[model samples]
Target: MKTITFNQKETSPIALEFDELIPDEIFTWEKSDFDSYMVPIGNSKFPLSNYFDVEVEGTAESPAEVVMIINGDLGRVKYIGAKMSNGQIVANSSVDLHCGAEMSGGSLLVNGDAESYAGREMTGGELTIKGNVKEFCGASYIGDWRGMTGGIITIEGNAGKQLGECLTGGEIRVKGNCDILAGIHMTKGLIQIDGDVTRWPGGQMQNGDIVINGKLSRSLEGFDYQEVITDPTISGKSFSGKYIKYLGDIARNGKGNLWLNAEKNRYLL
Candidate 1:
């Protein structure tokens, strides 16, 4: 793979948007090209070279052959891999909003935390976050009905509210705790929460499956307890536990499968 590295020189006063510097667009560019490239700030444009030292190694004929490494604190950078169709991006520190939004192909790895809207409306590919993510991760964009039509998002840490809201396809796995309204209004896909959930998952969801392997603080009235099964198979994955299955977001007259660990949610029994 052709490797390109961006080492942060200094933190910017305002958040910098990285929608333009992704491998799909910059894989063939040399250092000189980056030096002259204008990156969008809040409202104005500034030379990309102002914040990072660019280093390019080898060459690539296509974006898929490129690997972008961003090393340093990018807490003030947004949209690190937005809309990329192919290639790989590794952000080594916590990133700002929209880190991997609308990506159709490619892989994005955030070694640290990510802000809201990560993987919003993504159609395909894989996104892995090693740390926690804020609200709306894998959710739909504002005013958009479809969220994350395809792709897989694996978060090694917690996730905030509305995760996978309005989702139509794909999968989301949160290894840590999750906030409320997960899989809200979702029509398709799968969501697996390995830790605790605050409340109200699968709210108004019309279709899809949600497997909660940990404690659920509360359950919504929209669901109807279906039955209990031992070692239930959910979304083609075998789960080793006594699980309570529920069907509905009946408030919307919808049918979605919600599985909760029976031992952790005995109150629902």
Candidate 2:
């Protein structure tokens, strides 16, 4: 396997764009190639060597054989692994916006917090975030109708608003709290949240499933209450406790399913 390591040496006020540095594009690049490469920052370009000490090791015939590790403060680095088709990327610190936006394949593991658009419009692969994520963690771009169409996003920490906005496919599992409108406008997909939700999940969803294992602050009137189920299975995953099912977003004539833990949401019963 080929390994590439980037250790941050300096911090930039303007975010350094890294959409061109994925394993698919740099699997065969030598250290010298990285030294001469210019990185985009704001409206200008600068030597990547000025901000990071790069090390390339081993050989690879394909992008799937590559592994990239980035260490140190990368809070100003944008697009850490955007549009990658294969390979693995590990970031050891908090990342800026668009961390894994538009990725078609491969795996990205962020050891710390991630900014907005963590897995926007992803079609395949896995994205794991160890800490909290801001707004639009797995949603569509501004003015775009398509969101994450495939893959899996696992968030160990809290998620902000519009967690899976406009989702057409894929799955999102949140181990911590979630904010409002988790599956708003979704057409197809599954979202599992293990923590409390602020309000209004599946607001305008047309077709999809949202399973919330925690308490919900409020539910939208657009969803009509359905019968309660016992130890229901959702999207092939089984739950031990009873869940209350609801269907609607009839405001848009949606047929999405919303399941909430019966024990946690007694008021809804």
Candidate 3:
């Protein structure tokens, strides 16, 4: 296996892009290669060594055998693991926007908070955020119709608005509170939220499922309340306790499912 470590030497006012530094592209790179590499910042490129002290060890013939670790504050680094197909990446500090955009495979763990667009359009792999995510956690890029086609995203902290906007596939789980429009326009996927939601979780969704374990502050008029179910199994994941099931977004002729905890949402009854 190969291990590459990047210790931040300095911070830049403009965000440094790390999309090219993923294990899929650098698994065979030596320490010398990193020393001479240039990283993109805004419209210009600067020497990567100017911002980070890099260390490379071991060897890898494939991306799956590589591990990348970034230490220190990376709040100015964008696309930290974008488009990687394999390997593992761990960020010890908060990250900037587009942390794992378009990733097809591999795993990325953010030990701190992340900015918006954390996992936009990812088709495979896993993304775990230990802290809050601003917005659009697993959605598509702006103006794009297709969103995450596969993969999983688990947010330990709260999530901002439009959490799974335009989602086409895959799954997202939020352990903390979530903001409005969690699965708006989603076609196929599963979103499970263990904490309270602000409102309008499955608005305009054509097909998909959203399971909320916490109280919902508001319900959209487009959804029609259905019967309550006990210990439901949704998208291969089972949950205990009674849940209220509703189907709609009928405003758009949608047929999505939204399940809310009956115990927490007595106001809906």
lDDT per residue as tens, model 1, 1-269: 79999999988979999999888898889989989999899999998888999999999999999999999899999999999989999999999999889999999999999999999999998999999999999999889888999999999999999999998999999999999999999999999999999999999999999999999998789999899999987877889989999999999998899999999888878
Query: Residue 97: error of model 1 in Å?
Result: 0.3
Off by over 4 Å in 3: none
lDDT digits (tens) for residues 1-269 of candidate 3: 99999999999999999999999999999988999898999999999999999998899999999999999889999998899999999999999999989989999999999999999999999999999999998998988988888999999999999999999999999999999999999999999999999998998998899999999999789988889999998888889999999998898888899999999998877
Query: lDDT tens digits, residues 1-269, model 2?
Result: 99999999999999999999999999989999999999999999999999999988899999999999999999999999999999999999999999999999999999999999999999998999999999998899999999999999999999999999999999999999999999999999999999999999999999899999999999999998898999888877888889999998999999999999999999988
Q: Which candidate is the best by lDDT?
A: 2
Q: What is the lDDT of every predicted structure here?
A: 0.94, 0.95, 0.94
Candidate 3 residue-wise lDDT at 197: 99
Whichever of 1 and 3 has more TM-score, that candidate is 3
* Candidate 2 global Cα RMSD: 0.7
